[model samples]
Target: MTYTGDVQVGGPADVRELPALTICKLAVGPYDNNAYLLSCSETEESLLIDAAADSDRLLALMAERPAGAIVTTHQHGDHWQALEQVVKVTGAQVLAHPLDAPALPVPVDRTVEHGDTITFGAITLEVIHLRGHTPGSIALLYDGGPAGSHLFTGDSLFPGGVGNTWKDPERFTQLYTDVVERVFDRLPDETWVYPGHGKDTTLGVERPALPQWKTRGW
Candidate 1:
């Protein structure tokens, strides 16, 4: 089935997809940015992604299980509007790529790099440091986890094309190379991609568009 932005996974009714690796999605703030709460059913441990906006809403989502860490995908202001508030309440370790850490609202408690792995209960998420969208944009890939293979791409790879590089050909090239080598080429086609905003897509569908993306230069 195709992934749509309306296909939400937050509450009980829509929890049928994967209960083991529970993913709660929230679209908040003016830009309607996507924020995710990834929780491990076994340990009740969770990780927060983006913390984009609407601090109250994000805090409510973390009521049951406190997040051990809040990972910032990049340094963009839109993606981190509510970060400071969330951290103040949850006391989650702020994680970001060293290069992007300076742009964040607060100091990055933990610096994540390419190939680094983060543990949230039983699952270990691999960090992919992607360039182009932002120098230190990152995506999280879960291999053989409870929900099988899944990808959390924070403004990197999306349904139609890669994230905007502001027409910077050089940055686009770097992002393209990183996506092909680190993601599509390495991961299985079944890997589900949950983007930072809007809909999600499978690697199998996006894999065929790599050439077009390069040629067209988005």
Candidate 2:
């Protein structure tokens, strides 16, 4: 998850190297959402995570690289603000959890649940269902081999705490429990976390604050 420089709206940060992939993080749209391009180094095919916003910008970032699909991390409006345009222009298939499919602007080409894995070239992304951030909120995990795993968390988990729960205590509880048991506890500390917005963080750093969030009732 270590990176340098900032990706202004319509631009991409320096590429990050992983075991079999190259990751480019772009800050796009009015919301400053983070759109990720995870490319398989061997095949050059990439998966766009959370088309968030700015079709022109996102498109420019992709350039001539072939994109396999546009995967919606959750149902939140901001996360998919530019989804329709991205899909239309790139001709990439759309995938999402059934619970959040109805919230998308276009029909989902594929519906995925926990334990399902999507493959593009030599890389495979395993889905992890995380509720509360959105009813069908999900994360993608790429086994990084010796480098640990890569986690794409869509507004479910973040650097300092879990995503905003809209003041719903029940939602907060659900998200917290899922994150703790499904994420921090199950994954190794070296896991890299890429969120829907802002900077990325590692699970090792975020693991210790679980108690604080629970105690604060956020």
Candidate 3:
């Protein structure tokens, strides 16, 4: 089967394999939040992104290996509902941005900023801080070379548009600018986007709509 990045709560996770990493995307919690388990193919060491909710299911997915850390994309309550429990069970270090660290359930082991690199075994992910949705919302980047770049966008960038700004023009502008300059201009169009919820999309599919998203002020 192909990895389409289409997953639903209560359904099985979708897996994508790259040359050096394997990404397991599972949707958990009532909000349909997407949590990613990124494992190094060479070492089998893994990192879980978001924890979200449903510790049992997330733990089961990690039963065969040890988790090095859990990265909370932002301070949103829905995004970290299961963080405390999962940390208790796995003892994984919690990573988050400094601005959002105070809101998380567990104390953050490390505060990551833009351009920081998170590593486990042979896998390396670059952190991209995207504001507006939350002061410290972030996206993770994995450059797979020939396989193309992959972005774990959290609530920053999605299929339709950037994350909601609650009708605030200032916030909408900030988010739109960061996404366009830091993400759209920096990365290639083929970059695969795995959002915080729902299915996936690519930069190429969304580039043309940038103007519309800006004009709509969403």
Candidate 1 residues 150-206, lDDT tens each? Answer: 899999989989999999999899999999998988988888888888777899988
Candidate 1 pairs with clashing backbones: none
Flag the better candidate by lDDT, 1 or 2.
Answer: 2
Q: 1-218 in candidate 3: lDDT tens per residue?
A: 79999898999999998889989999997999999999999999999999999999999999986688999999999999999999999999999999999999999999999999999998899999999999999999999999899999999999999998999999999999999999999999999999999999999999999999999998
Model 1, CA-based lDDT: 0.85
Off by over 4 Å in 1: 1-19
Model 2, position 79, has a per-residue lDDT of: 88
Candidate No. with top lDDT: 3
**Cα lDDT for residue 102, candidate 2:** 97
In model 3, what are the clashing residue pairs, if there are any?
A: none
* Per-residue lDDT over 1-218 for candidate 2, one digit per residue giving the tens place of the 0 to 100 score: 56752566656565788778998888887988988888988989999999898888778878867577989999989989989988888889999999999999999999999989999989999999989988999999999798679899989988899988998999999999999988988998889888888778899998888899999977
Pairs in clash, predicted candidate 2: none
What is the RMSD, in Å, between candidate 2 and the native fold over all Cα? 1.6
Worst 10 residues of 1 by lDDT: 7-16
